[model samples]
Target: MAVEVGTTEPTEDVIDVKEVTRAERLRSMVARHRAKARKAAEQQRVNVARRVNEWFTSTDVTDAELAAEIERKRRREQHQGERELRDRVRMLREQLRAADENTAPALSAQLTAAQAQLQIRQDEDADRMKVSGRDLVRARWMKRATRIGAVGAGSLAYVNGVAAEPLLALLSLGAAPVAWLYLGREFATDEAPVVPAAVGPDGTPIANAAVPGTPFVPDTLAAMGRVSVVKPESGRVQGEKDLVTALIKAGIITAAQRDETHLAGVIRPSGPGWTATVDLPRGVKSSAAVSRVEDLASALRIKKSRIEISADTTDDGHEGRFVLWVANEDNPYGSEKHPSRLIDADRWDFWQQGIPLGGDARSTRHEMHLLWSSLLIGGLMGYGKSYMARLVAAAAALDPTVRIIVITGKTGPDWAPLRHIAHQWIAGATPDIIRRVLGVMEQTIGEMQDRGTELDRLYEEDPESVPEGKITPELAAKGMGPVLLVVDELQELLDGAALVQVAIEDEPEGGGRAKARSGRDLMVEGFARYVRVTRFVGGMGVFITQRPDADSVPTKLREVCAKRASYRVKGDRSAKMVLGDDAVANGAAPHLLGEASKGVVVLDQGDEQGHVTLKADVIDLPQFREICLRGRQLRIDAGTLTGDALEYGKEDAAAAAAALLLTDCLAGLNAAGIDRARTERLMELLAFHHPGRYGEMTRAQLQAQLRDAGAGTTKKIGAVDGMANANGYTREQIAAAVKTGK
Candidate 1:
């Protein structure tokens, strides 16, 4: 201990160390192994149960099953081919018997070839049957041998201790026998070859296979069974499922009501999309689905605009039926419009063939019958309201027998191209222009009356020529062409504020002022009368308005219009106003059209189907101008050019304005039933008739004008009714003055 400070001394103390036997260690290892084995066995049991369930329930085909199915299909196709060959041979023999000498040789040759082909098919079918039988026998033998071999291998493995565990040995010994018990029945008895039955196009079983000369008849009950068969899901079937699911989700139909409704037929291609017919439940109407179009689109994950639902009003049973069309593109109407058919037309036969306006959703061309009908077009601004109207005007212009009178409240270039061919082109929304519009309506009313008189005269002189009491093409060609009045921006002329005030100097009772009447009121009355009387006399009116409210188009006028076209509008109210409440209820959805759907309109031609939604033909300014030029040339060739066309840029504005005064004076005299009137009274009537031009005219000026027109000087005249004496002219004087002026 006294050696060095860094050195340590060792001291021994007794310590006990625990030691285990080899047997205990082996027991611990064995316990861990047993736990893992138990866990693996439980997992194996679960996997086996899952596999068994899947094999029983899964629709997936195994390799052997798939091969067998393919072979069966091949046999069926071969049998069908043989049957067809036999039918062809029999048909050729019949045709040969009926053939003439010139065609007999060809028929005989075809018959011989068909018979040979049929014989060859029969021989091939026999060979295939033999081969199929041999293959089946071989397959059965192979399965039996595999079962025997598996049993031998399992027994040997168990006896040689290759399977260590008792459970493993038992599984090995039992697997082959289990497979035998499960599969042996398939090979125990030989089954007859399955003969493919004759099936219809819809996969329904038909009657027994036809003899060579007999017809193949379908079984009605079996045919009905086709709808009940479990078929592999197809695109159409999936689409139908999706539609039904959407309907259910949309609350349009309940799950319990699913079987009560059904698709009328298989979904089929239509235009650029797919179409299907839905047969609704008894209490459901097609409008129910139409009203829920947006809900359906949302559930189906499609654009709302591309889904079109219309009532199938083709028959009495159509109340519960609807036609659904789903377009592939978001915008089925397309961004660009189709060119108008009238643009290239040399001359439209408006009498025999109607105007080709545009194509429907199915791309089917639709024609508008302008004869014996009036058209009312309405919509929001910039939605092709004017374009649609001008299209009609252009179509009428192409017909040389149609006299076009275009009056527009808009002074834009939308109607400029039509001016070249118009009989009376009046444009502007000023008070003067509105008065002129009223004046035009009055003149048209007079023309309608004159035409009616002429038709009556024709009916009396040559009743056969006017058999239907309507204008004929022959009569139209003989200087009695139809008159078409196209009024654009009609609301401007129909506004309540457009009034004309006139002063009465010589009242029958005393000098009193006459109440002012709006030009709108007069125009509406005149138009109503024209529409009511001119339909049979070859007079058509096309009234277009951007404002489709009640005030824009009066009820009386709208009721008389037989044809209606509505472009995109703001709401259902406007749509109903234009197309009628019944039309909208029946499934006309013009309000659904978006800004991209320019030139698209819903036309209600008073047909049983409610309305036709179509894209109007596009006639741009250049094309329209060219068409009008062509129309002008046509009118010139037919010797039918008159009115503004005859005096375009040649008539003096002041002279034309002055000339209307004499006509107004004479109209006033006729209206009052007076032979003559005082200068003050005549001026008042003139002011009322042409408010813009003559509202401020003086009595001296009117007398001077009458004096210049070869009428005698005014003098004191007794009141024709109960009025005081006044210096008025006679009706004869005014009539003579008008005649002299003309």
Candidate 2:
């Protein structure tokens, strides 16, 4: 190369050789880098393989974790077992412990403390059971002496010739030794008699009998006078406890029965005697409590009638609440000086507080507010049934806004005073009177319709006028009457209706009879369905009946009349007839009422599910007349009374009488299909229906009368047997004429 370089000088081939060397160096460097990367990858693969192998074959590690878990479970179970064993050992140690000297000092101390606590508890129990030693001793000795005296009396009676005395003497002599053996026995028992409060005849509270010469003092007192006012609080407390204990001891209440009736608290003096409120146990009703009243009174050594019990449901509507009034005397309504006054002085403002029913045993006044009420008054004859009905009627009469209607089926003067205030009065049970009653009912229907329309209009105009959804005093003051319909002796009406029905079915009478019967049935159904619910609509119905049996008064009417008053019924059967099916079982024994219970009645306690004793107010005829006269004057001043009642004219009387007669005749003759009648025939038919007005009319007079009354109309009549006939008037035409007062 040195020889050629010398020859060729500088050749371009050197540059190419240098470039080739650089390229070769670059390739070698790349190969070295790839080899280093391969070594790194191989080391990583080896590390991964070692880790995986270690994971699969590490049995010692798995065994270590499993051993740790097993140790934890063992410790948990062992702890549980130790706890249970400890409890068992503790119980055993307690069982082995004793309260003797050998016992531990702590246990002995505990035993001593327990004994002392027991003694303290016993002492406290004795204190709670403590009673008046003086009263208890006196009563106990008196009872013992009474027993001894009875025995001695019986021995003397046996010496005489009294019947059954020898047997009583022998029995007493036989029991002497046994009784003497128990002579020193403690006379004080848990049960003691309740000493009742003293009350005078005028219902004034009397002082206690602890002093001499008091009226309530025991018969052993030779000289008794008025005692100082002894506070009855302590005595009442003892009485409450003793009452329950005596009841239990006398077997009126068993140990299990204790839960059935509970004495609420201490007795409280109310009215004549002490009143104790009691809570009837589960499944026991006020009626059940009432049934046990006699036994309860006997257990307390009081008269049966003295125990006045009133059973009612609690205010919360859950259990039974019984009020037991243990009176010193038998009379509860003996305060003649305190006649029941109206609950409120303002009759119009307090219409809902309607009329006073009477005063209760507790002197709480009750009312028979008939604003939205239908009442049924029933009882045996002469047992104040008529009196109660009259009382309510009189109450209605006292209100000028009330329009009174009396359907007195019986011909009596009991309701005679009602006529002065009555807008319509039917006083007998004759056929004509029955027809008049039917007319009255029809008129009542018309009145109801008119009132309903007026009421709607009034309400639409101003709802304030109809307060409480009823006819308020303001609405009634505007010449809108609150109608009251009194049906005394309702059975007669029912019987008359039934007879009419039978006659229609049997065809014994005629088509008129059929029409009359149909009308009656319609009116009765309408009355029961519509009129019964009209109380809130300003119409009230009072149905009085001697017999409230199903036949006399329909079940619909009975149910409609929600307020029932029964007095002196024959038995449970009759009582249930007036009240309800459960009346007898609910302790409504009206038959047991004595003759002295003239004004007393068993009144239904609506919605509370029982009956209560109510003494009705007795208003004489003179008082009723005064009330009627006052009401009449008020109505006149208010311009509510008008027509014949206010200013009767001869024409007005004749028109009214003719209208009544026309109604009676139309009811019978309309069914005959003879609407058009000759004047003579019409007069004859009217005479047949009501003989009092049309019976003496001649053909000319009747024609003139019909013409004057605007009942005569000209209508062509068909020729009969080739004879000319004049036009005749129809019953409808006559009725329309009567309404117009032509």
Over the stretch 1-742, how does candidate 1's per-residue lDDT look in tens digits? 5766586565875543333466677889999999987986666566556544534443122222323444566668875886687567657766876999999998878776776675466446434532233454454455556666776897787677754666776676779666544532221122122233445459875432111111221222223222211121211223345566667877778888877777664444455566667888899888888888778777767666777888887664478898887776777777766666565455677777777677676556677787888999999888888778777888788889899988887788988877777889998877777777777777887887898899899999999989999889999999888999888888876763255532223444764665566666777777888888888888899999999999997888888898999999988899989989878877788888877888889999986656888888888888788788888889989998888877772444445555666677788877877677777777777777779878987878877766766676887788744578777787776677667657
Top lDDT prediction, candidate number: 1
Model 1 lDDT at residue 222: 29
Clashing pairs in 1: 508-723, 675-730, 675-731, 676-729, 676-730, 676-731, 677-728, 677-729, 678-728
lDDT against the true structure, each candidate: 0.71, 0.60
Steric clashes per prediction: 9, 7
Predict model 2's lDDT versus the native. 0.60
Q: Cα deviation of 312 in candidate 1 (Å)?
A: 1.0
Can you give the lDDT of residue 82 in candidate 1? 64
Report each candidate's C-alpha RMSD, comma-separated, in the order given: 25.6, 41.7
| lDDT score at residue 701, model 2, on the 0-100 scale | 76
- Per-model TM-score, in order, reads 0.57, 0.51
